[model samples]
Target chain A: MKFPFTSEQLTKLHARIETPALIVWQPNLEKNIADMQALANRFDAALRPHTKTHKSPLFAQWQLNAGAKGITVAKLSEAEVMAAHGIDDIFIANQITQVQKLKRLRKLHERIHLTVGLDNPRQIDLLRPFFKDASTPLNVRIEIDSGLKRCGVTVGNDLVELAKAVARQPFLRLDGIFTHAGHVYAARSAAQVEAIGKQEGALMAGAKTLLQKNGLRIATVSVGSTPTVPFSVRNPAVNEVRPGNYVFYDAMQIALHAAAPEQVSLFVLSTVVAHPVAGRLVIDAGSKALHTDGAGVTGHFGLPVNIKGKVVRLSEEHGVLELPEESTLRLGDPVLLVPNHACAVANLFDVYYLINEALQIKTVPVEARGKSQ
Target chain B: MKFPFTSEQLTKLHARIETPALIVWQPNLEKNIADMQALANRFDAALRPHTKTHKSPLFAQWQLNAGAKGITVAKLSEAEVMAAHGIDDIFIANQITQVQKLKRLRKLHERIHLTVGLDNPRQIDLLRPFFKDASTPLNVRIEIDSGLKRCGVTVGNDLVELAKAVARQPFLRLDGIFTHAGHVYAARSAAQVEAIGKQEGALMAGAKTLLQKNGLRIATVSVGSTPTVPFSVRNPAVNEVRPGNYVFYDAMQIALHAAAPEQVSLFVLSTVVAHPVAGRLVIDAGSKALHTDGAGVTGHFGLPVNIKGKVVRLSEEHGVLELPEESTLRLGDPVLLVPNHACAVANLFDVYYLINEALQIKTVPVEARGKSQ
Candidate 1:
């Protein structure tokens, strides 16, 4: 992986900063945003980029300014944070079952145009007590099990039943049907990702048809997952696309051929603190900095830019890189590592350094980070 | 994994709180701390518990009150946080090479007794500019490689040379030798863990002797790593032991037979958000909350209490648990999951809920969380 910054530029940046810092190259970041938005435009789909990746309201605002319809979050707390930052239209793409969270969600709905995902009757029952007497009905999207079996209902009878359940509630409005093709991360090749993507689109479209046949007025048909957005958005039946990782792609995106190295804007800047042997070097960034989420997908902890090595091991604060014997990387030398997953890596830091093309840095607070609940 | 809390207590707690939260069972937490301290006392070793596990100064204060000599941190930022909270004595068990961090270290040393780990000459060179002319010498510990292989110098000439280099500097004090046997996490059996623990102790003792023979005084001989602490502290030559995870044992420790189920204190209180299939239940906690650091040590993401199932899959905000067909877990049901590694999980949350035997709760801020700079 080649870094976007030159060695001299990185040297000047590293001179005044600490190690294990998250760097967001602004030029690449803007390009990534524009490129993904252009793709959504070409497919005539609204881009509701997932805020779970950047976790910053500032980044969400940038997406909204660059033609995103709104924003998507994985949890209610994240949505609350984004709403607090004046992001009005938000979609929570995960199930919110706990009563306390539902109460918070109802309060948030009064302040913004909030849409939540629901896959089961239990969730609707839980939400009824809070939304039953509200002036505005809560917009809910029926989640369909496209390929990722972690959540969502199966796209046949289960989908129809869930949509009906939501539609029957006077306080609940069945706004759409959506599915996330997260199984694309497991695809061994680009062709496999494409296959899963197409299947995901078909499943969501089929679910929409099934729901409409059952006299449900579904307004939105959305497909999520960064790797599958290209193929899933191609289905004319889908009106919205939510892809988060494309904002700052990482090693896993590269491994799945979803993104090129130059498109990856996020990096963990670390300093080689230990050269223990002939072929091994240790950096200050470890699991706490880069995260271990995509280890299984990439078969490595992270990829070091401009180096022929792999982050083979990670403790809480140490990353052990296995390098070639003659590698010039020495102690105290700085290395930028593209984490296995950018979303998980973004959650680890309180602030990220946004670097412009001139290498001037600005601090961006990850305001919604760790708002997992 | 058996939860320390009763179902009634958990239900009440879950009713008022959000899901995907971290809970510290106070009774179990106190017991784990006492047990480890008693073990260290039995072997006549000082307990410098690593604060990386809890990341809370209040928890560190409890350990110190329970007869801990000092506290150990993984980074300079952690040490700075601990020091700000009036923790006057801290040993950073990792290298500090960055000039900016070294500058901060110099400032931190003025207010506290700070000792840093050093394994190479480059680190010593980095320190010279800041500590060379200081009135108070900065304490430096020679890091010996006791089979972790991530950081630290070898036990022979490399150790001696690093010691000599530290002693040569006017403002740098060669205070001790330390090693973390993290490789014990890879031990396939109890016997293998025991073997690695013994080797760790022997290597540290041997390195101390080698440095002393070279006319360098080594005051502290410390060994770290939770699973190996019991065996390593038994070595008469070892004077101090640092075991962070013993404060909150998790599934990884249970897998290594280091701690039993009852001793586990920390848990991710997550709600079952989806029951997509008969055998699969998806919880709200995932890699963002529980962390994926110990997935390699334990073949599962986490262990659910009172349930005969494992967390089979983890996305950023969802945990997919594969259970038997007879299981009674349903949507909106609360489940307490013991994470694979408590340290990494602690880093993910900003606050931890400390619950007493009476089922009362108090929030403890993870003061040093995200201080990984």
Candidate 2:
């Protein structure tokens, strides 16, 4: 495999950077962040970039330092990591239940300006015992189902009831309405993404008005996900966008027409270990690195831009590349690939080798990786 | 959602056991080890259980202690972790090339009885320089394609050519021949798995005999992959079988009919965080926890046993479950799921909470996880 940077740039990197490594192209990553922040600014939305994508406290801090309002995490473990790193404004965009998890949440909430997403009264009831005596009220955004059938209330009586239930708890603050337009990732074109985004902003805005009319105040109406960001933020209804993958747009984003090749930031650096046949090569990076998630748009596992070949398939530890005929690639050649999903790939790695705009390399442990809880 | 264990069993477990966890049923795991060991004993085939399934040094030591001849790993990083844990014999059942990696192989070889898999001559030349003045020769097994056309030689003249080239290097020892019957996972029944196994054993035996007659001495005729272990290990001609997932059979094995549900040893312990609507539930475990790969055999992502539901789909952190009608499951209810592929799921977690037969909880870090390099 070749160094993604120039020979001179490679010379500046600390020796011993190897293949099957997650290399975060910081220049591109910073640009992606700047561009996303600009998008949020254009639409007068507060940017709370999701830390779930990078799962790195350092990266999240970079976004926060760059004017992001806060960060969104999917798990309590992730929020714990961010909070440990002094990221005070943390929103867990997932339900938290279980007596044990609620205790942890209550404790963490006491430390930060924590806002959790809640859809059902059962979760609220579970947290009641812990929150009942909480000195600081736990804030919650009503997770409403916009279009994605994955989670959230369906913006009706259920939404109204949950909002009221959350409001009923003296220790719980009914903050705002939140919805994730995840279905936008499945959209075929940019126009479709825009349509889904419009629906999302309208849905969240509608939920806010509905809840407010019912005497529950809503503060932050948040819409996020990389694919829906550009479109959703454009709508007048959204005030906050929480696009995590924008920190590292992957092949999935490119396939969805949500990102350009130049904007794709993270790459799985691999080394061709075997040239089993003339044109077919096997790289050390496999499903564990590139991940097995479908390339949402391209149908390929990953795209190796430097080589004129495609990562066709992946076993647990072997990436099979069907190279172009008459290719000059050989054994030990460094191949770089943009993965299908940046979030999944990030979770698969324990640490990421950060390559600066100047291509100097350093390593940072993926602090919240495998923090799925 | 329901727990895999009975109420009595759950009562005996550690009070703080959490969700979205990788729990190793140590009793079942030990039993699986004994059963597979019995299979190896029946035919006098030495067991070289692949460590790729667990990627845990602690687990690999258990296999080695259970009378495994050696341990097989998928990557050098995995081998390094195993070797660090005092596993002297390691067979990296994958090709290794590249100047940097070859140097690492040479260095690691100096410490252990390491054997790497190779298919071509260029790899030999690359190692030739490093091993030219080595204290101990680098042992290599020729990898032949049994059925999985992913790697290895075609097993005729190509095998002979590669073997002869490996032997030509004073630093390389063409010790054994290896093949992985990964396609056995696609078998429709135990009989189909046997057929694939028969083909694999016959092919490896045939290749060994052909190579010996062609003037190269060969030892260690190895075959592996958990699905073919039962049938393939029965072949007396095979000396070493490296099936790793037998330590923890999952839904994929159950669908292959290679394992019974009672034989399943690992479970992704999760919690029903959201009952989005009636009968439908969302678990805190998503693709990052349960993963998104189909069961390869049944097209199912994961099967939650005591709970009558399929983990229908997964986002990054939300597993959408389609529960049975009139189910009494609620928020905070524990769910235990047998993943489609245990190996993939294991890699997704930082540690496995070992629940012994007595139902005590202890954590063992997945030592080699994310060691993709």
TM-score (all chains, Cα) for each model: 0.98, 0.97
- Judge candidate 2 at residue B35 and give its lDDT: 85
lDDT of 1 by residue, B1-373 (tens): 4668778778899997787899999998999889989999999999999999999999999999999999999999899889988999999998888778888989998899999998888887788888877889999898888877888888777777778888888888889999999999999999999999999888888887888899999899999989999888888999999999999999999999999888889999999898888889999998999888888889999999957788988999999999965578777889898999999999999999999988888999999999998
Candidate 1 chain A weakest ten by summed lDDT: A324-333
Task: Write the residue-wise lDDT of candidate 2 on A10-99 in tens digits.
Answer: 333313567788888888888888888888888899999899999999999889878899999999999999999998999999998766
For candidate 1, write residues A1-373 as lDDT tens digits. 5679788878788886688899999999999999999999999999999989999999999999999999999999999899989999999998888878888988999999999999888888789899999999999998888878888888788778777878889999889988898888889999999999989888878887887898989899999989999998999899999999998999999999999997899999999888888889889999999898888889999999867889998888999999865578777789888999999999999999999987788999999889998
Q: Can you tell me which runs of candidate 1 are displaced by over 4 Å?
A: none
State in Å the error of residue B132, model 2.
1.0
What lDDT does model 1 reach?
0.90
lDDT of 2: 0.84
> What are the RMSDs of all candidates, in order?
1.2, 2.1
